[model samples]
Target: MYSSLTEIFKILGIVSIGSFSIVGLCAFLFKKLFDYYLKEELARTQSNLQLKNEKLKIEIESTKQNKILAFKTLHEERALLIKDLYSKLYLLKVEYEKIKLQETSLSFEQLNSIEKECIEIQKVVGLNRLYLTKSISENLNELIKKFERTNEILKDLFSIGENTFSSMSEVSNYKPDQEEIEILHEKLISLISDIIELLDKLEESFKLLLNIE
Candidate 1:
């Protein structure tokens, strides 16, 4: 009996050690699998984040480029409008000088032509006033009014009908009555001075808008 009990105890001890070894092996394997899966998931998350950052950068750059292009287009258009308006103003000035210096009696055709040109100038200003500063717009209107006044003065001088010359060369050779020619000539000179001043102001305003030194 004593020998048999000792044998039974040794068997139980062997069995317990084998069961513990199996449990320990299973726990170690589980830890290794968990670590590997955790590393893979973290790497995936980091790659997704990097892709998102790259996409965001591209969108922002595209927006910036579009704004720059829009600004460039606006500047070019504004410059063209200003240049065109100035050229028209110069033509109007030439017309006024012609009426002021013409030696012959002004024809109805000449009067109508000046009026038509003035209307066209006004139309341009009214349509493209957005491109001009408020002060410039107002001054342009004033300049057109002066053109009208000059045309009216020319009509009055033509109505006097006392003197007629074939050529502008004869204007300096003939002296006119003080009451009529002197007054009209003085008015014309004053209007010309005003027109010049307004032109200078318009030029300064354009320089400011274009950021010119």
Candidate 2:
């Protein structure tokens, strides 16, 4: 009977040990799986964050490049406009010199041509005035006014019919009073000097703007 009791006790102890081993094994496996899955999730989240950062950097770079390109294009366009204005002024200056030196009677066609040139210069300056400095624009306006004044002086000296042109094709062959011509010629000389001075100023301004030495 004692042996039977001892045998039953031994069986119960073995069963208890087996149950504890199984529980420990299950707990170890659960902890290992949990750790592995946590690590994978953290690694995936970090990777996603890195990719997002890279994408953001690319977007920022693209925006910067776009701004630079836009500015460069605008600068080039402004430079072209300035060059165009300079050419127009140069042509006007040549015309002024020719008119000043000419001894023949002034034709209506010549006056009309000069008026058209002035109009064209005004149009160019007015249209792109925003690209120029305020001082430059004001000087240009003053230059136009001087050009118109010179034209009016010429018309007054030459025109016979009410001192105004009635036809662009008409030629004014009537000689202006010699004394009046001399007086007005002095005025013309002064105006031409002013025009040359203004031209010099504008050239310097343009040079500064274009970074020319």
Candidate 3:
């Protein structure tokens, strides 16, 4: 009976150890599976975040490009209008000089008609006044007033002086406020330069801004 009891205890000890080993193996496998699942979840989350970040970057870049393109388009259109208007002023300057000098082949009647009906430049200003910068628009209006005033002064000189345009150009006494006329010419030249410079700067800035195209 003593030996049998000892043998029974030994068998029970072996059975207990076998059960513990099985439990430990199961626990180890479960732990490994859990760890693998955790790592996969973390990787997936990181990939999702990376995708979102890339998409957001693309969206921001697209928005910036759209704004830049819009600005370029608007300025390009405005520049064309400004260029045409500037050219009109140049033509007006030529016609004005003609009238001021009373050049041959053009009757005073024709020049007087041109002076009175110098509405083309005014019309261009009125139509696109909103497009022009405030300084440029105001300066152009002031120049127009000066042009008319200068024409009136030249007309007065022609009436007082008794000679043709060729001889009249040499008469220093007939010139009323010649220095003032010179100043007006300078201002007009400056304005033309300003318009040209502004347009050129806009174009150059657009080119420099976009390296992609």
Winning model by lDDT: 2
lDDT by candidate, in order shown? 0.74, 0.78, 0.63
Candidate that beats the other on lDDT, 1 or 2, i.e. the better one: 2
Q: List the residue pairs that clash in candidate 2.
A: none
How many steric overlaps does candidate 2 have? 0
Ordered list by TM-score, greatest first: 2, 1, 3
Local error of candidate 1 at 157, Å? 4.6
Q: Compose the digit string of candidate 2's lDDT tens values, residues 1-213.
A: 999999999999999999999999999999999999999999999999999999999999999999999977877777787777777777777776776677446776677777898999899898888888787788788888987887878877776346465664454456667786776667667766766776776677667657787
Query: Candidate 2: where are CA atoms >4 Å away?
Result: 1-31, 160-173, 182-212
Of the candidates numbered 2 and 3, which has the greater TM-score value?
A: 2
- In model 3, the clashing pairs are none
Instruction: Give the TM-scores of the predictions, in the order they appear.
Output: 0.67, 0.71, 0.58
After superposing candidate 3, which stretches have Cα over 4 Å from the reference? 103-135, 144-213
Candidate 3's residue-wise lDDT over 1-213, tens digit each? 999999999999999999999999999999999999999999999999999999999999999999999988777767676667656655665565554354322345554655654566667778878777776678667766765665554455445233555553344334435665555455545544544554454344444444323
Better structure of 2 and 3 per lDDT: 2
